[model samples]
Target: METSDQNAAVDALKDPEAFSVIIDRYRYQLSRYIQRLGAFDSDTTKDLLQESFIKVYLNLNDYKPSLSFSSWIYRITHNEVMMHFRYMRNRAQAFASEDALTLFESIPDELDIAVESDARLRSMHIAKALQRLKPEYREILVLRFFEGKSYDEISDILEMAPGTVATYIARGKMALGKVLQEMNITSV
Candidate 1:
């Protein structure tokens, strides 16, 4: 059986238009991932997305189908996002974007709230709590929970060992739980 994106990568190499298919498949996911990494502005996020796709396309041959394609692409995206942070680090402004809240919106509410009037408020609180996390902790949480990547997949994406990924997820969950607790938000 072909790896998830292996065939697409092959076709993309032969036809430039085929690359668009891959872009369409991953654009939203990559956009969200980029935002999670600290990009908030549409312009900067768009630029990084384009740059990431270009890099992926150019490096298609280097991709090993034996590995998870999702991880490989995320690695590229992660690198681009990190570069953005490095560039913006000197500007003295923290990345505080409401776009991150949209990620929570994608998650289905466990129960319809007929009584609680503060669902949005709670979401904002969670978003702020997430932002308070160190980038590594936040990234691991996002990948494991939001992106739904397996430990080995996250390992490949972050270029760490699987054991390292597990350790990060464990520690990240604890850190996130602590932050939520500080905000009086019950752990879900």
Candidate 2:
């Protein structure tokens, strides 16, 4: 695969289709990226995804070709998402504005609960047990089991040392297994 730096350099020249290629290449990954950042299929997430790409393109020239484009793009997406959250935090105080709010209120409460409960079925009994874990542990479990990404990939994505990633996965699995027993979920 071509590096983000290479893509960025091409995109920096304002090549008509180059930026679009980058978008096509990264859009699925970018969508998953936003989902992991806690955005759903609402207008807010949709707007954020659009804004993140524009931000990436506008700043493409600033990217050093030495870095992984994947990480760089993610960093941009991460920053934008975090910034949006920060803005919401500030705006949350100043306004009772329905216009600024996400459409989460449109979701049925029972539906959301059922969906969360269904998430328990993702990892089988073992995965169900893992749901009780802290966010950090749950993250490691999801990145490994649900996404099926490599340790190196998880290491790269999580920005953790490779060995640390391994240790966390091992421990997380053990923790999940323990939880499974407590929940009376038998491992096959």
Candidate 3:
């Protein structure tokens, strides 16, 4: 049977080796999330993931049962990425092509492309448009759409009020739509 994240956390607190379960469960999703946040390259994403996981391990005691474990972990990962951007004194760079393709594919319901070839062509445009968005909008949209987070989860992860999370998501979607329109790709 699959152990719950809460159970894994409690176990890890008692037996450090049990932390491996937490790591195994979160590793791939968090790695993809780190990359989607525009970590430059695989090495950068790996470094950030290592640092974030270390933080998660060290702060295991701080995990409140009130928040979902996924939200709490995502919060840590988000903070790590923000700190990396601040340290580098640069904004998020464009996502790698594969990341872009995956991101666009994840939101097909919102961006209804009729053909696979058109989807491929529009993926590049969408990536550039996303790159052009305000960091706040981009991050919120990424969390909401690509990461498949609910508003409450986003609120917990972003430490924002639920209403504020909803507002940001609305504005972010509008901004993304406007950007795509400006690119003359209005299928969305």
Count of backbone collisions in candidate 2:
0
Error of 1 at 143 (Å): 0.2
Per-model TM-score, in order, reads 0.83, 0.55, 0.90
Name the lDDT value of residue 159 in candidate 3.
96
* Ten residues in sequence with the least summed lDDT for candidate 3: 107-116
Give per-residue CA lDDT, model 1, range 1-188, as digits (tens): 53247788899999998888789989999998877656367788899999999999999999997787888999999887878778877311244446544765443232222122355655565566667888888888778777778888898899899898888877877777687777766644
Order the candidates by lDDT, highest first. Answer: 3, 1, 2
lDDT of 3 at 171: 87
Give the clashing pairs for model 1: none
Put down candidate 2 lDDT per residue, 1-188, tens digits, no spaces.
66455855576567855677777777766665554444344466678888998998888776765556776676687678768867776211211223213212221221112212333243233323433665456566656654555777677667788899888877776666566656765442
Q: In the order shown, what is each candidate's alpha-carbon RMSD?
A: 4.3, 9.2, 2.2
Better of 2 and 3 by TM-score: 3
Off by over 4 Å in 1: 1-4, 90-98, 106-118
Residue 49 CA displacement from its true place in model 2, Å: 2.3
- Against the unseen true structure, what C-alpha lDDT does each candidate score? 0.74, 0.58, 0.82
Off by over 4 Å in 3: 108-117
